[model samples]
Target: MTDLDDPGLLDDVHPRAVLAELFARQVRADPRAVAVQHAGKELTRGELDDWSDTIAADLQAVGVRPGHLVGLAVERGPVAIVAVLGLIKAGAGYLALDPDLPRRRQRALISAAAPVALIVQDHLDRLPTHHLPTVWADEAGLGDAARPEAPPPDDDGSRVFHVVSTSGTTGSPRAVRIGYGAVLNRLRWMWTDHPFPTGAAVLIHKSYGLVASPWEMLGGLLQGIRSVSLRRDELLDPVLLTDAVLDRRVTHLYLTPQLITGLLDELDGRTSAAPDIALVTSGADTLPVDLVHRFRRRLPGATLLNLYGATETASNTAAFDTARLAEDAVTVPVGRPVAGAELSVRDRHLRPVPIGVRGEVCVAGPPLALGYLGDAPDSAERFVRMPDGSVLHRTGDVGRWSADRQLEIIGRLDNQVKVRGYRVVLEDVEAAIAEAPNVTAAGVHAAPPAGDTVLIACVAGTKDLEIAALRAYLRERLPDYMVPSRVHRVAALPANSAGKLDRTRLADLAADAERPVAARTLTPRGPLQSALATCWEELLGRGPAEAEEDFLDAGGHSVLVVRLIGRLEKATGVDLPLREVLENPTFGGIATALQRRAAR
Candidate 1:
């Protein structure tokens, strides 16, 4: 308790300090500096400030005031940055509506946020229709009028700065409210510890819908460093992303482990020198030691850090530098708490556990977010008030402190499932599978409780690794109840937009794997049927059980469905609409529809 209150634990930034004020100082210091770069255009600090001030005036005219929440549905560009700065200048927090997500999901988030107004990028159709007053980012008349002279709204650090939607893989999404002070603390700590050099640039490639986007886009800007924005299509192509990093002189890059692996693979194939990045940070998922070693080999000069936090913690609380890690280290510790933050491993009773004992990882500090926006019960449960008047966030993650004070994360408490009356940790099973020869990655899921429940696993490995051999390897290392009953081999595991493992998609694949083998041996009837079936098998990593076997039942999700449709159209030389594939979700149904369309 005393450690929690220690003055040294606080960040150097004043509690009353806000990002808007800090950014203004940077603008005044160097107005001619490039503030943001996108596509082939650049915006200087003075120009950006003027543009945002115009937007702020427009928002204020519409009755937007301090503490109001505004919806920003803009794509990644200079205009998007202007919208964010304008929202803060107007003293209104922003809720970014990702244009790539489904319209329904965007609508759901807007409903939860209940924002007073919406700022949109022209021609963006991914958002649902709303009655809120709209301001177009790409409007021809924008910034045409003279800039208003009204002073910027005052912020004491208690006002909400933004709202981030939780992943909601297991349930409905919840909006997490973050304050100006919380994020300012996070950015200040990064600036102090990993100082950005002059002429340095940060690649703002992550989706604005994610919690990490704010820091990725603004952390460098507040320090007068340039931010380079990448379009979604460019981000998906490894070569394009690598080229952008090199061409833009990006000094700081942050990505999840999955995306990092892709970038490393691309670098391995290149004859050119690796990009001269100063710092590379990995977060949003576990950083595998193998990946860390690959980064070390690929970018020897750059510092590699593993950051650990959640949407509720302003994106980062602890960081570990893998530069000096030993060769034989099995796991990477998340390292000590960042400035202005404190970490504790506590038991179910909210009592702190001794070092080296696993418990729920709780974070307490100024970086902690306000809480869930609309869900009071959930906010109360996850954000607990300690007897000392300090608020701590229960991360639901299992972790322990090492003898040297490093934090080692175990697995999630919710991932614990009962199998054959014995409790088992899914991550432990995945780790055992990953240890198998040539197995690159693994994901495990537990089937719904029935008369006899079972465990399923999906592994991505070399062709030499057979399912029989993998099962035997698991049996040797894990208990009988812990051994997965069914295993599926794939080219690679799927990842979400944020570059983290898509657990829900993995569970869908596992469910498909759980079906009996005899039922999955259907024969294609014609060339059209065979081509469609081939595409389905390739995408799902398994064949259909019957002609009527549903595509979704065969582990196909929304993201996979799009890929499937694209492949089908290419292979068959026929135009297939997305709705046609979704409406006819069965192998027989889609094949018949495609044949008819081809004949017509």
Candidate 2:
């Protein structure tokens, strides 16, 4: 065992062993600094560290021992991160669970995790009592736990600490164990390189609030800075996200394109002063070049950075500084690996491919996680041993190195997509679509649903895809991406009873872009509102759709609809359209302003 107190230990090189040791020192230095803020609440470093200690002590009291399996429901905010740190402090590795999970599905995960003690908020009595022990993480419970005495620490980075659930492409979620050695390796790399400068704090976008950023959670822990944790769903809601940023005066933050789109659209109404934020990071999904340009145009002072990583590799293994975005967007590489991590392009044979050659992404570092748990034996084969006998988790994502030795994400080698930054499987979208009302059967494709970041589906009639409505149905069971972006209703889908789509035919449908079916939603009209809405709905190919509360915010592509006048004439029976919809927009004063054209 290693004691955390050895001087200059972390300065030279440290491992997961060093992470646990830094706990007290970090607290001592920044005890009063704000650690997290959510729903009008704030937690400080001393408070979180103290709470983590208690959580660790409490779990130990409940028969949780070193290496015991503990199931942690991954939720947004301070409590979630504290719970995970508590597991490590208790000498147990934790399994992450998403709170929004359906009961039966959650039950299956609980069964698989077989956690000795589960940490969860009792807010929803939704999770049924399990055969295994349970600990409700309410206010009273937290207050009663004891503070953890720091463990005798070491610099050994190889200790196991967590089991992350990753559903690659589609299947049951596999738990990937991330060891201490790996965690330390990753945190060291991040802190040593792209730190937010000492004393600078960062806000978690809350989309990934469940998992701490190497910079936000651990990096803050190790480096004596603050990671302002915002509530997850609340952040998704624009007003709340903006308020959180301003109120907290966040200096650094990370978000995806979907989020940036919303934030940028909503920023004007929220506050005149942009929060103190300087660095805005994005990744884990495609960063649209247009959106990147929009941010620079709007917030000329803000720095946008793109970070890339996966569960297999610790969060933020590589980052592309957004400053590079002004020059060239698409060609921007994922950039140099953090401090000690190594990223490479490997060929099918698992051999390192030459720079600029496309290959499988392989990452090796102290922060890399162990292989997936309880998986098919063959899955283990993907773990390749390097010449020095080190292990690298194979990220099936395809990428290439630039002439400058930077890694660039090409796309997924599998059939998965991240919508709004959440990884979604196309098959899952199909299954959910199959469950839609009046939907006898369906097939989903990554086909740009009417050019929006949505799944495309062909339903059973001339019935156009009621996207907003269908989304409501899918939201009941599946995550957002599983809902098809557009549902096409054809009397008969070209499929065999053995049931497989004639993808060739579907591609043809997408090509003609004939999805004129409108989504079902509260209608907007007047000449300008109605005409603009009609063109948008048609060009995008589906909607009985209610226009967005904010037009520009809903994702309008000016280039995609150059024929705005013709399309509007075809749908709304009126037109005075200019170069684009932006020319005139609103129900109060547009064409139909005189006669109230009812919502269809």
Candidate 3:
């Protein structure tokens, strides 16, 4: 038999055959155990099982069937978990839809998935403008129907379990289809190797739509560990989240590098021991050596693990536990493959490169997702066969195998990028920006000259666009990180001899054009304006400021606004509210607000 048919190539996941089956087993073993806690609501395993059973029956009544896809527009809470589990029991795959998304984008995603029905919470204040039939969380008479049982595992493991959307190069949603076997293999591996002490609570920090969400939500459930779902507001404030972790006695936590940095900053060199934390997982960007050292020094009792994976791989394939890592290491290695994963560094022709030589990182084994949702070109290009008849995925990331068999990722081979742990396609950002009103063309680039990498957009529009307005427009359509940090308006973008956009020239322009607009001629007239201008200049990275120059247009964001307000309050001894500062973002306007507050 070929490798595809060879039973030895794949492991048989028994007892806990699939996710729904495993969850059912957990419920049977400890029905009274707390399975999830979110926003003061504690759900026992028995409660969750019964709740999900009712929801599953309701879903089945609404025509949800095996292998069918359903839309989930609920936020992070107990209901979200109930919906996911209930859908699994109904033998349906779910596509998580972000409720905060704009109506247009939501409609587009619904059209793309064509889910049989949308699952939403009854308490949600807003609903997407779509024609799909919806199943409300608070539907009546669901308990009258019998609970559905978990379906048997598909022998070939080709059953789609769920779908997560990643940014596409074509400016549309790229839905990743993960199969039951692929998810089961990863979950089983985590349950076997990454064991948490009994009663440990995994923190669900990311949104339900991100790939990390599954690992946080389902990974804990697989091993009978309780999960704590953070509130949406708590996620935006690191200080609040840190306090929640301490208050909730959270043992397991997951974060991106950016959030880790923010949390570290909040801690501010407090090396006091926090022994309650057993493990801390981080990914989305390369974890710096200094940060790892800092984490070990402070939280010595916990293990800090660096995970490396993609959405197509069903989550992480490799992990490096920094607690045992050497301090003098130059570059933090991505570590060896995790359970059931195989890694190889190969050249363009797919030939294995020698150890210590940098090449494309390829992953083989059960952790691989079935493929992209539909027959997209990238689907075939990513999953290809080897001469040995083994299916390996081309990760497009460059890496090398060390002498000790560790893998160190160097960089990507394409323009696709990771901004603060979120994958983004530069072309996608440009496409979205170009489609904005009054914009003719746009070029976007990730410029990281001195480690402070930020996305810069160079646009050629028919009419001059307000920086704040443009940013607000883009934020509604794209994720925050995909929105350009700086927007440089130009008459026209430069083109090469082939009449195609010359990205190299655009990069040079962005590098040189750090100051987007000329300084306004109106200089600070009084002491208050001068002091406010100085604060603005220092925070915005500008040479000098003008009274008429808008603070937002000068690259000042909400965070910077907070900092500026704090400094002004301390320096001027005036109590100023954030709304006052934001209402008047110009130098003169802020000065006036400060003067009025001082007079009061």
Candidate 4:
């Protein structure tokens, strides 16, 4: 076994560094620089330091100590950033919770984290059922007596920095404990390789509770770069995102491939290129070749990078520059390992596979997370010690090493599914659905045959169970994507002799149970409506559509909406606003609107 302290190998920098310590260094160096901006609120480094210190003091008073996990429930804003930094300053790890997530899910995640205290932006009256002490963001008279301190007294890198919840093997969410040192290492890597200019403004539009949020919000603090938080609604609008980037002169921006595609489509009809951006990093899913090319064309001045990694590994293990892709390259390579990281493709036997052979993708690095918080068995199984004593994290993704040594991700080795860029385990959705009233057993899967990835859920329940009610139940407890496009009442879900779920049979049953569209009672009144209805029918793969049937309920999602709108624009030579398309989604409403537009 290779010795860890071998003199020949260079020692890692920031070895004993804590995440808060790194950010504190920047605050001391430039106190007057803007540290964060959100809505109309801006906080300078000195101000942010003071604010975080006060919150930390409040946390300290509430028994929040070193290594404690604090649940943070707040909207995406300057206050949210303050809460996160304050948790770090208090030497406590934070579990970020999206205020908008279903109360049940929030409660479940919070219960799993078992935080000593829960912090929120304003009122905590609406918070889910939890027994933890609640700390309000506006703790006015509590800690204002003392002057703002710098960082905390503690500088232990071994303490857990944050607990990130990801799709678990079971139905519940698995919390991953990441050390302060691991988070610091990732920031150090970004600063060294993809250096952002000191004090440059960076747009942080990613949602809370996601792994990427920390990288965007805190990573910038290490280099004195301003972290600008965009509200959830602002992040959803393409035009707003473009404007935000340009208005802030954002030097660094991160997006998923889906967002990138939406932004590209928004920019397509524009007369000029978007304002110059320094770096645009994309991840969370495979970057499509077409989207890469479009991004290059739309933002020629920006360096577009495809980052590949997982929640267990903090951030990126490998990065691919779209500019390096060969003209004939069919798949965009994930590129070589990042600094202080190693990539190995190993077969089922755990032996290294040939360079060109497909196998499980494994990563080893200093930035590797501590492990799954409460899942020791899973942690041991996924993180294995090699014969040489080095640890390797088996990322269940299947990929192969290219001729040029780049990693190409091909597929998943398990039941994990990604919908519109969010990673989800199928069992998690099934578990959520099974909790519904009267649902005896539930099976959920992402069906690709619907022309798009539409979630189809089948449940064995009483004959009187309503599909719409079941959908509403899921919607209240899960994200929209996790909700089924259609809920089919199955007599009983088939299982194999070994007692495992027979997914093949479940899928077949789901396919056979889909509802066919009924014949239209009302004929098209005009060519505009007639043509649009025909297009909708073809896109929905249904017969004549009902006038009031919800478009999304009819198996359409945001992705399909884009394609449908694009087709409508091409067919009718009329530029339509996305708001109109969404608002008048039904055939009768859309048809009438189109006819009116033609009249104009």
Best by TM-score: 3
Give the least accurate 10-residue stretch of model 3, judged by summed lDDT: 1-10
Model 1: per-residue lDDT, tens digit, 81-198? 8888888777788887767555655777888889998888778844787888877666465447435444444455667778877533222346788887887788768877888877
Rank order by lDDT, top first? Answer: 3, 1, 4, 2
Relative to the true structure, how large is the alpha-carbon lDDT of every model? 0.75, 0.62, 0.76, 0.74
Model 4 lDDT on a 0 to 1 scale: 0.74
Please provide, for model 4 over 33-65, each residue's C-alpha lDDT reduced to its tens digit, 9 standing for 90 to 100.
888888867778877777777887778878888
lDDT of 1 at 12: 40
lDDT of 1 at 419: 52
**Predicted structure 2: lDDT:** 0.62
| Residue pair clashes in candidate 4 | none
TM-score of model 4 vs. true structure: 0.85
TM-score of 3: 0.86
TM-score, predicted candidate 1 vs. hidden true structure: 0.73
| Cα lDDT, model 2, residue 74 | 46
Displacement of residue 294 (Cα, Å) in model 1 is: 1.3
lDDT of 2 by residue, 399-503 (tens): 998877778889866566766466666665666567666677666656654234655666663255564566556555553344454555556667645677776
Give residue 347's error in model 4 in angstroms.
1.6
